[model samples]
Target: MYKNKYEPALDIYRRTLDNQLKLIHGDHRDIAASLSGISWALGYIGHTEEALEYSMQSLAIQQRCTPSYHPMLAHTLRAI
Candidate 1:
């Protein structure tokens, strides 16, 4: 939803993301992916503090779920 109109999409995205996250178990990859998407949308809309926070969360999850040298870890780090 970050494609067409950024701010509005983020508002919509935020409203649903948390509830979805609650249904996810542990530190799943899908949780990290959702966090990354939210972070990207927040960053794109100039909410840098929130963006950074979510990105950091994503990074932490990726770190725990993947190997140190994993490609996804590198990607999540770059995202932050």
Candidate 2:
């Protein structure tokens, strides 16, 4: 749904991302979710390398802050 409605959905997602990033700009682990959003959007836009890079970055951050078996960590791992 979102992938097909990029123009409209993107603003909403971008706003959400801005808010979250504002709260945890330098906290890589805390901003894993936002990073995931970026990766998702990049993937939807066909930027495979950028998407994978962001996914890996998010995965690394989550691994550092959460347990290895955490749900978000799992998602990030699979995404990469």
Candidate 3:
């Protein structure tokens, strides 16, 4: 039941990430946010390894694009 709920969400998050990657040329906050969303969905679906990977990717982007004290960086770190 839980898996059923998260699976569709996971698919949507993946599609969003893909679209963001296509539309945006470089590392951007929106892409990082999308990656974070995908990470959250993957974590909820028990795909912890994949979730961690996405989370780390998000963190890296956030670090590069955002200030050191940015809230998004903290959020991504927490997710990691």
Candidate 4:
């Protein structure tokens, strides 16, 4: 999705992320990664508000679950 710049990729990312969240348990780092991808896709597709919500969710998860200096958290912070 990030590499190709395709708008339809947002829908695919959204569906996959939703399914991932349902299957994953607890505060998993993989969920955060999925959220970040969804947020990025939303932003690219011009859904700025939804993007921000997902970004915030991803950041919150990272802050709660990952190390303070984790690269994933840093990446999400940059996105926000």
Best by TM-score: 3
Please identify model 2 stretches exceeding 4 Å from their true place.
1-3, 7-22, 25-30
Q: Clashing residue pairs, candidate 1?
A: none
What candidate 3 gets wrong by more than 4 Å, as runs, is 1-4
lDDT of 4: 0.86
Regions of candidate 1 where Cα sits further than 4 Å from its true position = 1-4, 11-16
lDDT of 1 by residue, 1-80 (tens): 33568777666667656866778768877777778888878888788999999889889988889889988778878877
lDDT of 1 at 24: 75
User: For residues 1-80, what per-residue lDDT tens digits would candidate 3 score against the true structure?
Assistant: 55457778888888998888889999899999989988998898799999999999999899899999999999888777
State TM-scores per candidate. 0.77, 0.73, 0.89, 0.84
| lDDT by residue (tens digit), candidate 4, 6-80 | 466777777887898789877888888878888998888788899999999989989899999999998999999
- Model 3 lDDT on a 0 to 1 scale: 0.89
Cα deviation of 40, candidate 3, in Å: 0.5
By summed lDDT, the worst window of 10 consecutive residues in model 4 runs over 1-10
Pairs in steric clash, model 3: none
Writing each residue's lDDT as its tens digit, candidate 2 over 1-80 gives 43476445446666776787777656566578867877877788788898898788788788778887799888887787
Clashes of 1: 0
Poorest 10 consecutive residues by lDDT, candidate 2 = 1-10
Clashing pairs in 2: none
Candidate 4, residue 71: CA error in Å?
0.5
